[model samples]
Target: MSNSLRLVIGEGLEHLEAHRAGAFAGDPEAIHQARVALRRLRSALKLFRRHLNPSARDGFNDALRALGRTLGAARDWDVFVLETVPAVMAVIPDQAEALGALVAPAQHERELGHVAVRALLEAPQTDAMLQDLGSWSGDRVAFSPRKAARQLIADEAGPLLDRLAKSVSKRATGLEEQDDEERHGLRKALKSLRYGIEMLESLHGRGNTKPYRQALSVLQEDLGRLNDAIAAVELVHRLPDQPGRLVIEAWANERRQEALIELPAAWHQFKAIPAFW
Candidate 1:
């Protein structure tokens, strides 16, 4: 388990570092990948919480979470300017010019957002945090020498995956009727469970986990699109109130409704899958 933890954390760190230059260059996919690496690292920490030192775990969790928020802000704008705006333009062709004009300032905001991401990436504090995480994952005293830490992952992976799966199931109990916050809660749970499965995939094999992962990917896509719509609402409000703003909001609302209608069926399909572990 301890060795596996080290491997997982190391992989996350490597994944995160791989995208730094691309994020600095304002590549949306790079920014998204970096954010995902952070999420996977945090999820790994939580997944292995029982075997970790509390103080070390909490500090790293807090720091990583702060970093995630910084990246997330930039990501939201990238989606809005790059994806959502283009999508709206395609769907509402007559309003394209007006919508483009309304979103011009949003493009500037996205530039500033990338600048902020660059600054954080270059910050000394971030370097220090990453160094500390590497040290911890390398067994350099950040993690306590607990019995649980020494246990074999082969004996532990199954129950951990099972617990994570059950958590997701519990969160999805009333999928279609869930409020935005509740649905967001489910999304987080699903992400954690998915990450858990991903981390342990080597043990379970791609053959065994592939179908389950595919199911998770589908459900997450729906949930993610819904989240984007909700975020678009909040983001559009930040723009100057204008006629096009109402159009964008309506478009986002329509997207939200579509996702809501499909969510229950997706949730059921996901629930029908047996726990892979």
Candidate 2:
């Protein structure tokens, strides 16, 4: 087997093992990391599909996708509470009283996260899928490098780009809504675009995809900041009416509006890149 193939499989197995151990211990971070590893492994498999048996590859892909979805919601909520919410609260001290309201919800999300992690850890499907991945990874296969690269671009990268383009366009259309949920969806779309571009760059040469990838990176960053501001505002909104809460809300709103204005031009520039779609 090529070094590239071996490296991919080894990394994947490591991630799977880590995830399994973490989930068994009920570690939220481990569960999230495991999902990320599965995603990376799935991407690698797609990129190198030509070297794998079709039946086995399909099975691995399906299993990963299912597991990813099962864990994704819990991870999203965890991130919101543990990372985004706390960070926002820290920045807006005046809104501290209002921010307290979110603690309950955040704690609730944490409980759900634990439950989701436990369920996935205990699932028989997890063991079967990991075993299948191990067996497939150990199998020797031959493929023409050039042919495999071309197939990867055609089958995986092309479709991913199409999906990313559609997602961005859809998100852009809804930007005018200017609500926490709408902006959150936009952030998710930007993340998808960013990851898709990164995956393509890994398969294709970075030189060929740099402009588009950089554009995506910029868009993702700007949108992410904007989403953060929106979430901050929502946090304040949830607080009991108070003088300090109003001040925080106003600050957050100002920041959000500025980001909104900055985003359109950045988005236009990104869309203008020839390979962005």
Candidate 3:
């Protein structure tokens, strides 16, 4: 468990460094990846809370989540400009100028988001949080015994994966026509499950996890695309009235419907796939 925890926390910090480099370079994917690693780290912490100080576990996870949100806002805009906008333009070329206008605001938002992330990273609280996490991962802080650490996979990790899967399957029973909130919940659950598996990847050989992770990624991407459409519509709603807003909404709606149509099959496939943990 200590090794697993160390692996997750170490990689998470490494990702934050990558995010810092990317932020300086203004690379969108770096910000996105860092946020993702933060999320995975938090999920890993939650799964192993029994081995950690209860107070420390929640506090560290909360701090990382707040950081993730900062990067997430920037990533959201990146998705809008790089993905949603392009998709919209392809379907509604006449709205190019309007879409360009949308990009301007999104770019501004992403810039502000980067500034926010940088500020958070520079804050004393953020430094303390990372330092504490480093202590745990680096063996300066002890959370569990050597025996416990080694047996975490066979004793604890597998069961957590099974329980999370069951929960998601129950939540997704009527997913296709489900409201926005339900699909959103499904996405969150799936990510938790994915991260849980990822944290244990070192325990399981890649031969088992590789295909499972790839398959899991397909559903994650589909859910992400669906959520992007939903979010794009919401973002457009917040903008000032313009000729392009309606067209963008129309395209988003079409995309949203298409995603909804595809999601159930993906969900079914996900359910059919065996757990690798």
RMSD to the hidden true structure, all candidates: 1.5, 6.0, 2.5
In angstroms, the error of model 3 at 235 is: 1.6
| Error at 213, model 2, angstroms | 3.1
Off by over 4 Å in 1: none
Candidate 2, 156-202: lDDT as tens digits: 55665676678678877856666667767777666656555555554
The predicted structure with the larger TM-score, 1 or 3, is 1
lDDT of each: 0.87, 0.67, 0.76
- lDDT string for model 1 (222-248, tens) is 999899999998988888877778888
Better structure of 2 and 3 per lDDT:
3
Model 3, clash count?
A: 1
Q: How well does candidate 2 match the true structure in TM-score terms?
A: 0.61
Q: How many Å off is the CA of 144 in candidate 1?
A: 4.3
lDDT of 1 at 194: 86
- lDDT of residue 53 for candidate 3: 65
RMSD of candidate 2 to true structure, Å: 6.0
- Ranked by lDDT, top first: 1, 3, 2
TM-score of each: 0.95, 0.61, 0.89
Q: Which candidate gets the maximum lDDT versus the true structure?
A: 1
